[model samples]
Target: MGERLFLGVDGGQSHTEAVVADERGRIRGRGRGGPANHAEQPGGRERLARAVGESVGAALREAGLATEVSEVEFDAAHCAMTGGADFKEEVIRSIVRARRLSIGHDAPAALAGATGGEPGIVVIAGTGSVAYGENGLDRSAQAGGWGYLLGDEGSGYWIAMEGLRCALRAVDGVGDSTELGTRALRHFDLKDFRELARAVYAGRIDRDRLATFAIEVERAAREGDASARRIIAEAAMWLCRLVIAVAKRLSVESVKVAAVGGAFRSLSLREEFAQRVAQHLPLARVIAPRFDPAVGALLLAYGAAGVDLTEEILSNLEKESGR
Candidate 1:
């Protein structure tokens, strides 16, 4: 028969990515677009549609296939979107006609990517935080995907929020002083925390920008701010709890855990997560991702198409993806 092809997409809060590959695990093209978590805010649906459209279209163009996303030809297409985007599949199915199509929240893709489609746990702490895992026996569980308003504990957004609170506390003379407060002032170009009121009232920053402040927290922790260190440690504990809970649910004592996203930038956070995981789940080990989330989605699509990837193909995928 003719060459077989597949498409994988990862749609997150900050960006959306699409990859086109052949059955041989050779990447044909890749594309990226704006944030895809549009349903949560005003005029988001349109943005989501555009992001998906742009990414898919760019990928198709790169592959020398049809540049129009709706008309691009592929045997199967799979997508992993932000948690709130349950309807992402419907939107995608309406755009392109593939023999097979699948869509779901982002965690599974990270899990699949981290474990190379094997059963394992994956914790993501980017703009948001969540953990998911599965066993070979079809037993799976997900935890900590709550949005910012409620949960997402240990996420970059959460870290930034924690740092801001710590900074505020330091300024209030009720808590230990920390470099984080000065960092916050610098971030907003203000003289002090009291000046933060003007920016907040004027919409000078939003969720994405707020999450970026997590880096300052990481820096502060690295620079030996005890309060910053505590915040980072607490974040690690929160993430560790997610893995611990997932392992408990699956009844698996020994499992490989993978860390993903921006919150892991701090050495303290990673080491603390590993240490806590060790103390709590002695048999589990935290490891780096073998493939990125997009490839993981592609692997899922391949499975959906009834293709079991051989080790040769897996090796080729890893080699070509440069991950």
Candidate 2:
């Protein structure tokens, strides 16, 4: 007889977020926790479980619903994770109970959030990069998202790795000499290339840690470093290719494209991406996201539970969540 409660979660390489909402589509609470990317890695399942428990538990408490994540029962729930859903579903089921559940990769959730479930494409550049689009006809397509080893061309990790490579090349006196070398040494708190190499080879600098340097690269570009500017331009070009590929595959003359994630935090990058999309696809428009991926998962939860969300309800969600 209590009010119907819904749940949404966005699990990414950098962090995990949980949102609690009421039947009227107003955000009740929000919570955050550490990363939950690869469930097949060592202790991945346990890490995923703990992340879910922590984020959900915090959200439930904030909503004044339950003290523990296990104590709360949801009418419906949706989870969108960086890694695929197959392995995560089992781990999630062991932690929380929901009458209806939907689980998938983060791309669709991001698209839903970007366009509010309408037909559109979303280009996400976080620790990794991917582009996904829907045609509103149950047809969808994706580009990139190959991860760090093979792809992730426009991602934060990629940008940072490129910066490091440029710096190393400068050290060898074979590449463009720029501020990246001095900046990287200061950023990593190392005295020289030998120390930097030692930290990297010893696994002291992991993928996420390296990705944090992308922001510094952006700083270098803003400060008028030619090599850094080229890196940014190239990253923008690669990301635009993703958008164009999705648009062509969907065969849509016009579509809204939204950029999401940490890499877009740089105004320079966002402007570059928007400009590239405009040049390549004149009909395509780059728009700001109406909601973050977590709320997009909540929207999917509402759909799965047969809840018809009105504009008023969505407005409440937007206003209350401050999105």
Candidate 3:
């Protein structure tokens, strides 16, 4: 084997992550770049190519240096993106030359990263939200990934919007004055709604900025704000429902679930999600992910190369990640 290189890329709404690893699953380099929501983005073809190039190129360079090689050859490339189904393969094929290139949705990438390619479920809540599940038989199902307008009930965007909605309600005298309002004010660093309305009407703030306020909602909830607590609880409930829906679709009595993405980083939210899911579906087990989504994409590459993620190899990967 002449330095077999496998590339895995996770193209997400917020950012793209790429990892370069050897055939043995030893991670050599990791890199990040811009969003790769290719299907919906204007100039999506070029944008997707640029983001994937930047991230994967950086990782490839790092790996090359580690192995004392001036250039590295890619044997396989596996990519998972938010709008992966619609991603034009030519965009990827134009950038990197590999013997084989595989592409799919980001959800399964998250699930594989969370469950180490085992049969399980992965729920993502970041700029967007989605739920993906795979049973032991390799059968799969998904729920709650209909974009922001239709659903995404438990996603970071939803929580941020809820925070803003509640604040607007308070301002309009329809809801109680709670810390959510204060938190929103502080999040934007504005003194009053006049500044907020002016900025919004002027198109000064965008949807991404709105989603950034979700941290404030979590913070206010931590400080015992009732409205904030309720918002977070509702988010948790929505997320839990995704798990139940997937389980029912899979027709499995029990399945391990992995909570992935920035949303589950909150302990309170994570614990609350577990509690709520158990109330309805006792077999839904929520566990921390073994690796990040990009790495999950890398593992998928390993599978394509006929490499099994054996316990020993998994252990080595864990040690490489220092987790």
Best by lDDT: 2
Q: State the C-alpha lDDT per candidate.
A: 0.86, 0.91, 0.82
Q: List the residue pairs that clash in candidate 2.
A: none
lDDT string for model 1 (1-323, tens) is 55788988898988989888899898888899898886657877778888888898898898887768866567888888986655666777777568998887889988888888999999999999999999878798988988898999999999999999988888888899998988998986888665686676577777888898899998999899998899899999999999989999999888999999878877888999999999999999889888888888888999999888889778988887877
Give, for candidate 3, the lowest lDDT window spanning 10 residues: 64-73
**Ranking, TM-score, top scorer first:** 2, 1, 3
Q: TM-score for all predictions?
A: 0.95, 0.98, 0.94
- Please provide, for model 2 over 228-288, each residue's C-alpha lDDT reduced to its tens digit, 9 standing for 90 to 100: 9999999999999999999999998689999999999977899999999999999998999
- CA deviation > 4 Å runs, candidate 3: 65-71, 85-87, 201-203
C-alpha lDDT of residue 216 in model 2: 87
Clashing pairs in 1: none
- lDDT score, residue 320, model 1? 79
Winner on lDDT (2 vs 3): 2
User: Pairing residues by index, what is the TM-score of model 2?
Assistant: 0.98
Question: How far does residue 71 in candidate 1 sit from its true spot (Å)?
Answer: 3.4
| Model 2: lowest-lDDT 10 consecutive positions | 81-90
